[model samples]
Target chain A: MPNPRLFSLKSDSIPRATIQRLALYVQVLEDLQREGADVISSESLAKACDVNPSQIRKDLAYFGKFGVRGVGYYIQDLIASLKRCLGIDHTWKTVLVGVGNLGRALLNHKEFKLRGFEVIGAFDCDPFKIGEEVSGLEVMCTKRLMEKSHELGVEIGIITTPPERAQRAANHLVEAGIKGILNFAPARITVPEHVVLEYVDFFHHLYSVAFNITLSQQK
Target chain B: MPNPRLFSLKSDSIPRATIQRLALYVQVLEDLQREGADVISSESLAKACDVNPSQIRKDLAYFGKFGVRGVGYYIQDLIASLKRCLGIDHTWKTVLVGVGNLGRALLNHKEFKLRGFEVIGAFDCDPFKIGEEVSGLEVMCTKRLMEKSHELGVEIGIITTPPERAQRAANHLVEAGIKGILNFAPARITVPEHVVLEYVDFFHHLYSVAFNITLSQQK
Candidate 1:
């Protein structure tokens, strides 16, 4: 479910860029909260995050006017609002398939957990790891993936399998009732329209950096 | 050094998105060229990639009139221009830091080599992994990263280490004479003015899908 705070904010209008920035702003605020900085102003947040105060104001405007004209926004209120808007307020029970290196790394990673995506179960064909735990999360066999996820109410699936097996993994995720799939495999994948897919290519990233660096040098 | 072709193309004032898409079109065309397709047009190119033909023509306009307006875009000519624009005409030498699952998976990946990025070496701190070969590429100690990289004239560094070590890897890369960094580590990194840094965060992909799904639900 989407955050009501985000819905309440932009009953009028919101730019795509503004919506995307909410994720970044939430991240910065989360860092602040961890640092014990409870009370913050827009100017301060902007300075620390290398963003413009007005831009921050506009981004927050999407959800609603939580900011005071003079006193500034309450830290907890904005954090809670952003958290809801970004779908991090509650726990995100996700399923990860193709538990290879990238998949294992993601499962062991605390970043997603900190952001609210808890990968409750992982899938793999490798018998050696299928019954083991990687950083406290159990590795379930692909055979039991759909049932486990269905019982757990997982709507998001992280696909970290290899390029060759990515399509098969995606098909399984869709069949298992996952509506959102993060395909880290390099090869492009086709999922049903009901399923939203994003490709996170490990090697194409290197290609992009190489492309940009090469372009900038040419100039 | 950067390719002479990319230098000549971007100097003509192409929009960033167009330039990026142009590179992709060139890649697809290269495949078509290999299959002996000489007179391909923008419509076929867009169809192959699921983009719009008008957008393709508009993007190509920035790089001057390469389209015949009737016979379609010249495959050989357009490919040559795109290769130069993206700076992929020359092979790029790259290094990977952090031989963890993510790093080793990439090291074993043969696609990077096929895409024109040669993985000259890999660096990590694991005592057992050092002096070992993965996918035929030797894993070297992070301690010798700078020396070995300079010796090989490596131009790009991919940071796949955990977030805590990501900055350290970037620092080492910068000190080692690398010009660009592609970070798989989930954090922001600071580098000098000359260094071109790009982040390929899997979280961004997740959050992006999350937001889109949320918005569409609202609709």
Candidate 2:
């Protein structure tokens, strides 16, 4: 059963692809802010990000009016607003459930930490890994995810377990009050209502690159 | 200067996010064909993939129409049509540069082989891995990528080298007549006008998932 209230607040008509670009624009704006860019017009932002100016304006307009017709947008204010819209304004506590090679590499990635996310807990079935510290994030037992996650009020979860364990880990993510899930596992998963699940398929993406490259070459 | 032919073929208007879903739809269609499903509608395909039905229609409209007014699309015919559009009608010989951990993982992945693309050749500067066999693919010296890629007319190049070597590998791809590149390295690599560069920003994607989940859970 879906927690009917989970997605009640967000714009239901916003294309997910637009939501994704919002994240990308936010990244570029964040970078620009670091470089002391005070004001940026749609044209400037689109040029830097290799996007069309109209597309940038359209994507932003989905939420509300943020751009000034004559002056453009304030970098700091737009960043803050985008962050809040994309749901990254506050620190989010989450658990990583794989601890595999990719998972380990991700924990060490500075970008995640910089994006207001903390890999506060990680879990793996391997006995040797329990209680170990990986990239300063504590490794815990897989069985303990529910307990730790609930106590932490984790609303988001990252699942990187093997395809075999992916479904089980996702179930646990749902049970632990996580309404948003980012699954890196290779398998397809089904989720109950009230939860938002995003699936990133590695092999599928690689295959797509291969296919597109082939087509572009053919042309 | 960009090869005018390739430049004219490139359209950045279609969002990469939408292209990704098209790839997913192709896979789902293939699966349906394998399952002996005769005809599939937009809603059926969307339901199978947990996406909106109108999205399937809209994304398909970008290339051309396929849906029947009432009978739906023929599974095999649509699969073939998508394959043609995606440029995967024929198996594309590909090269993987910078045989690092991620490279090795992708090389070892059976999914590529299953999708009609073959790694065929792998290149890296690391002396120890050169001439070694991993994932049933032979590792070659990075220095010879241009020569071999030319001989094979490698159409697609996958860059898994560190951020430092990303540009170098991308240059090699372009010089060797590789029109399509899937870059896994962290840094964005510039390509010649004729080349299509798609960034497989694993770290960026990871950060997005972590950050967005946190944001979505917000009030």
lDDT of 2 by residue, B1-219 (tens): 112232222343555666677778877787777778989877888898778998888877767778789888898888777666665666768799987766776776666766667778999989999989977877988888889988887878899888779999888778888867888776657887677777765434544554444434443
> Could you tell me every candidate's TM-score relative to the true structure?
0.85, 0.81
Relative to the true structure, candidate 2 reaches a TM of: 0.81
- DockQ of every candidate structure: 0.47, 0.26
The C-alpha stretches of model 1 lying farther than 4 A from their native spots are: A1-20, A39-58, A66-74, A125-133, A141-143, A202-204, B9-44, B47-50, B74-80, B126-129
Task: Label model 1 with its docking quality class.
Answer: acceptable
Worst 10 residues of 2 chain B by lDDT: B1-10
TM-score of chain A of each: 0.84, 0.90
lDDT of 1 by residue, B3-120 (tens): 4444444244444445546656765787788789988777788887557988887876665667786798778888777666556667889899998877877777767767778888
**Quality of candidate 2 docking, DockQ:** 0.26
Candidate 2 deviant stretches above 4 angstroms: A1-12, A33-41, A64-74, A126-140, A202-219, B1-18, B33-42, B61-74, B125-133, B137-141, B202-219
* Candidate 1 global TM-score: 0.85
Quote the chain B TM-score of every prediction: 0.88, 0.88
